[model samples]
Target: MFTTVRQQGWVDGSAAITGITPYASALECLMHYFREQQTICKKCCHVNYNHEAIQQCKLQKVDFIWVNRDLENFSWFLQLLNDFENEQLTYLETLRANNVTSKRYIDFHFYFTSLKSNNQGMIGYAPFDLAANIYQNVSNRDVLTKMRTKTILGRPQWSLLFAKFKAEHRRTSVFFTGKPVMGEDIKRWCDQYQFMYYHEPYF
Candidate 1:
C-alpha cells in the first residue's frame, strides 16, 4: 500500500488521512496515491494535478492512442470529415469575432516533414491491431503527420481538435482506456521521467 503525508488547512476543511489503506498490490497502491494527489491538488489549488504531475515526471515514453476497432470503416471517416467541417465553422466564427489572430498558413508539406523529423509527441492518429499493425501505424505517427500538415498549428487549436475528435469518435471509451499501464510500468515511467518516487513500508 501507500502512505502520504497529508497537507493540512485546506479550503474544504476535509479530514486528512491518518493511515494508509492496504492495497492488493504495489500498482494498486500507487494508482491510489496518484488519484489522491490529483484530488488534493485540484481541491486545494484548482490545478490539474495529474496532468502537471505527469508532465513534471517527464516520461519520454511514446504513449499510444488507440481508436476503436469497430470505427475503422469508411463511415467513421465520413463522420470525422463532418466533425472537421463543423470545427472549421467554429474556427471561422472565432476568427470573425476577432478573438483570435491570423497567421501565415503553411501547407501540408512543411507540417508532415516536421512531424517526421521531430521527436516530440504525436497528437492524433487512427488505431489498428497492435499485433498486426506496423510501429508507425499503431503508434499514430502517420496520422499525426497528416494532422500537423492539414490542421492549424497552434497548441490551443490542436488540443481542441484532439479533444473533439476523441470525444466524437469515442476513442477513449473504446481503445485508450482499455489498455491501462500496470503498477510496475507506472513506477518505471516515473523513474524514467525523474519524478519524485515514494513508497513507504507498513508499520
Candidate 2:
C-alpha cells in the first residue's frame, strides 16, 4: 500500500486515500496525492468558500511533497509557490503606492484559482494596472482568449522585461521546470549568477 503523509491542513474526507494503486511510480503517486488533497480542500470549502484556506491546503501539499525530496515534481510546485508569492507582493505594493487599503483591491485568489482550473500559465507582467485589468476583465472565454492573444503578440517585450527583472533579482533563486536538458544560454546564465537550477520533467 502507498503511505499517505498526514499534513496539518488536511480535512477529514480530503485526507482519505483511495483509487491510487501501490504499483504507481513515485511521480504518479505524488500527483495522485496532491490531486486528491485539492479535491478534499474544495469539498471542505463548500460551506464558506474560504479561498485562503484552500490555498493554504495547496501549499501544504507542496510542502509535504517537498519533504519527500522528490526534486523532479517538487520543483514545479515550488515554482507555483514562488509565482503566487511574487504576485501577492506586487499586488500589495500596488495598493500601497495608490494609498488604497488591501480590502479595496481584488484578491489574488480569484485570479489564481481561475488559472489553476483552466490550466493557464502565469503571465509575469510587472505592471499592476495591466495585470489587474486582465484579471478583472478576463472572466469569460472570449476575453481570456483575447488576453492570451495579446500576451502572445507582446511576448518579445515581456521576455526582455522579465530578463531585466531576473538580472535585478539575481540573488533570488530561479527554478525552471521542463525536461532535464537545458539550453546553453540558460545554463550559462544560471552558472554566471550561481542561481539554483531545478529541472522538473514536464508532467
TM-scores of the candidates are 0.21, 0.29
Ten residues in a row with the worst lDDT in model 2? 7-16
Q: Write the per-residue lDDT of candidate 2 for residues 123-194, one digit (tens) a residue.
A: 543354355456656652112322211212111122453365355443433333322433234445556656
Candidate 1 ranges with C-alpha deviation above 4 Å: 1-85, 89-99, 102-176, 181-203
Give Cα distance to truth, residue 13, candidate 1, Å: 42
Candidates' C-alpha lDDT: 0.28, 0.31
Candidate No. with top TM-score: 2
Task: Give RMSD to native, each candidate.
Answer: 18.6, 14.7
The regions of model 2 sitting more than 4 angstroms off are 1-150, 154-163, 181-185
Model 1 pairs whose backbones collide: none
- When summed lDDT is taken over every stretch of 10 residues in candidate 1, the lowest stretch is 6-15
Residue 12 lDDT, candidate 2, scale 0-100: 13
Put down candidate 1 lDDT per residue, 102-192, tens digits, no spaces.
Answer: 3211111112121122123443322322321354455533343223223212121223433443343321111111112222443353354
Query: Top lDDT: which candidate number?
Result: 2
